[model samples]
Target: MKLLFLNWIFLITVCYSEKDGKHLEVRERLKTALLQDYDKTLIPLMNSRQPVVVELGLSTMSMDLQGDGLLNMTNGNILQWKDARLRWNPEVYSNITSIRIPASKIWIPDIQVYNAVNYGENSFSDSLRNPDRHLAIVTSDGKVLLYTTHKLQIRCDVAKTVPGPGEVFIDRGQLDWPWGKYECEISMGSWTYSSSQIDLKPYLNRNYIEYLDQNNSPYLFTEDSFKDENVITCTRFKCCADLYQMARFKFKVEKRGTVTAQGLKLMKKDDKMLLISPFLLFTLVIISIIGTLFTISKLCHRKPNFLVE
Candidate 1:
């Protein structure tokens, strides 16, 4: 009976793997279609005379330098159209609400921009773009998204436009997840970001957000039914990474017809850090032992030696 049960388990595992593979193929195809559609529809909007400004609300940022964990962005920034929980000291917000154009007669309303994130909750009303400090872009649209100095970098420039759509390539940051170290590449104009080695498709659903660790292997759904049993709310994982009290955020799942998200999640370092290489750990242990021995020796030498009598 035990052997039969083991065999049954093996078959289930194989079946799930097959199912996951098929689902991944569909996701890739959908991503490609979205890219094609975006290229055909939105590329022309880049030609406007008014500068396009991207506002990535602080709520979506993965790392908060300030203890607030949300952007009280004190710069020439704009408010997001959607409501967010980020607190603002009137003074700090003053810097973002509006920008002064030396002699220009126009005042642009700060527009909220998104990085096309899929794994976690990233709200449309966030106060900062590319909150994880992992994305960057350059474009002919003349839109700028404000962020801290540490995260600001040029990833690509809009070279030219084509009949179908303009092309854009942005740099992605190195993410250290349980899988390993790899770089992510987000191609903006095409509207797809891929880290072939990461395989984030498994965590695309709401229930699996924070629950996706090495253990408790969960399954992913093949279809795009937001009302599926897989959709869930992840509110218990909120934690902070910043030291200065300037940023803050919250998380919630939106269930209308299809399961969708309407809020942002706060950042928290996980136990993945515990998975450092054995060689690195060994080196640290050796250094610690040596330092302890040296301290003991110094203390013994300073004291009177009774054994010398």
Candidate 2:
């Protein structure tokens, strides 16, 4: 009976392993399919300037200084001052047009945009064409800027996209490039302006704008959803020659429902383990019952064992 119980446990383990293996296999295939499908279904729309909904998530703002004599007053110094702040009403930003994506369903793929001719020629001609033109971010004060910048860089964590336990599709081609870092420098002359304040806004509107891609192809899309009505106010400090300052902003915005339909179907399929697990449990119960009955019967059939009289 003990051996039978062990065998049953082994069998259940094997079944679970088999089921999980199948799920892993399907998920891998689905990831590949999702990447291809995104390139097919959404990439064109993105390139064509279709408005893709993005949810405004958490955001951060920071500022610092660089260069020699930042706090000192000296001759022939390049005195520069920079400050960063975000000016967006969270309530208003959330109320803006958006799609309800199960928090887990959103993913921002690691997007790489290579100049059309500089990098090795690839088959995805469209991607190679003006890749940077489609990617942009809105500041708190209604300014639109490209995701790629020389002094400032912004990036969102791939892990943060799926926070909860709910299953979500890979949604590969889609991207949610968040503001990662911002750095600036000014040199050559003594400090003229005392201090400069930059206001960043997060708002999206329905206004359409046109831009040229890397390939010089024309495209249009609704302007940034995150918009700020106010502008940054700056106060000049006492003139100093060798003053320098730098600023950085880090923010997270939810890019909801970027996944394709086919990818969603595959995600649901992978979660079918919830349905299949009950049957597996029932099999284990039956095995336990048989083992108990066999043990009882063996005891009952034992020859009457009386102390040798």
TM-score versus the correct structure, for each prediction: 0.22, 0.24
lDDT of 2 at 110: 17
Worst 10 residues of 1 by lDDT: 189-198
Q: In model 2, state the lDDT of residue 62.
A: 22
- Best-matching candidate per TM-score: 2
TM-score for candidate 2: 0.24
lDDT of 2 by residue, 196-233 (tens): 21121222321111122212111111123223232222
Error of 2 at 146 (Å): 15
**TM-score computed on alpha carbons, candidate 1:** 0.22
Cα error, residue 39 of model 1, in Å, equals 2.8
